[model samples]
Target: MLQQRFFSATSSASKYYKITLRRSPIGLSKDHRASAQTLGLFKLHQTSYQPANASTAGTILKLKELLQVENVDSIPTKEQLQANKPDRGYQVIGKKI
Candidate 1:
């Protein structure tokens, strides 16, 4: 039972492909633009995550020159990402009653 639990825990770890657009697709061939849109990346520096699979790999290869790809084991949550942002400086004065 212990061995089975360990195996399941290890298998539950997911693998995702973190794909980021590194360059503009403007003025490129129509096919390239279509491929980028199809992959859910339309603007420079935008990121999309997809499962690590053969079909996604093929699509990525089609527009590899304009993208940055990395294999990540986990995806960060929206709140987690927001928490990492730099805080804005504040200018405020308050009077206590």
Candidate 2:
């Protein structure tokens, strides 16, 4: 599956699944919790990406009750996602010896 994704991603038209956890799955069934984990969602309001494919579609279906999903033209790179994160209001300088 990785190899297939790798090759397909070389094309300019790659797509992604923009999945966000809209509600906590904390008190849900075990199946719900496992599906949430499968989608890389473990916290409320957390967002993650998955390749837009049939398998992901099936998983999304299983967790449809808890997720907000969309098909995206392209997945944001990690650096891009990081740039959009809220600042911690501090920066590291140097370690004290």
Candidate 3:
């Protein structure tokens, strides 16, 4: 029993959930809004990484309607997250002095 517990605890790599806010929380119940906030989703299309645990699972379930979730192998750093965004495609050629 002790060996099994130890193996289980150490063998499995930690997983992360990539959660994106697909819908607005406006007009929803306070509980829904609070759940979204707890998940670190404050704006539309905002993505946040959360550990795959009971509390995080509960929060995702509570606001599942407004969120899109995917299991990610690793969590992304702030720089990586920013880098994933597409360029606006427009550049300012000249500015008034």
Candidate 4:
């Protein structure tokens, strides 16, 4: 039998992280856009959350290289989400991103 230790499916200690795209790489290149798209991040001020696992970590890491990554406990409220939007001047209202 084979053994695995990186991340177990039966584990119950998984955490969630909030990933946001602060800046837009519109004029950067195709590669950057593809990277953001792969992480489900396209438009600026867009946010997404994922389990704190190796796969998620890898995606976050990739985005971090270009955008920003922040670990959050729970999903942000509607107001909270809207407050962090670009129109709000990208303010740090609800929480840091």
Query: lDDT of each prediction vs. the true structure?
Result: 0.88, 0.86, 0.89, 0.71
Count residue pairs with overlapping backbones in model 4: 0
Q: Comparing 3 and 4 by lDDT, which wins? A: 3
List the candidates' TM-scores in order.
0.73, 0.65, 0.70, 0.53
Cα deviation at 31, candidate 3, in Å, is: 1.1
Residue lDDT tens for model 2, 1-95: 99786665444554888999997888778987998999899888899999988899899998887889877888788899899999889997999
Which parts of model 4 are misplaced by more than 4 Å?
A: 1-14, 27-29, 77-97
lDDT for each residue of candidate 3 in 46-84, tens digit (9 for 90 to 100): 989999898999899888888999988898788997899
- Clash pairs, candidate 2, are none
* Two-way TM-score contest, 2 vs 3, winner: 3
lDDT of 1: 0.88
| Candidate ordering by lDDT (highest first) | 3, 1, 2, 4
Clashing residue pairs found in predicted model 3: none
Error of 3 at 1 (Å): 11
CA error at residue 86 for candidate 3, angstroms: 4.5
RMSD of each: 7.3, 9.5, 5.7, 9.2
Which residue pairs in model 1 clash with each other?
none
Q: Which stretches of candidate 2 lie over 4 Å from their true place?
A: 1-14, 82-97
- lDDT for each residue of candidate 4 in 46-71, tens digit (9 for 90 to 100): 87776777877776665575666766
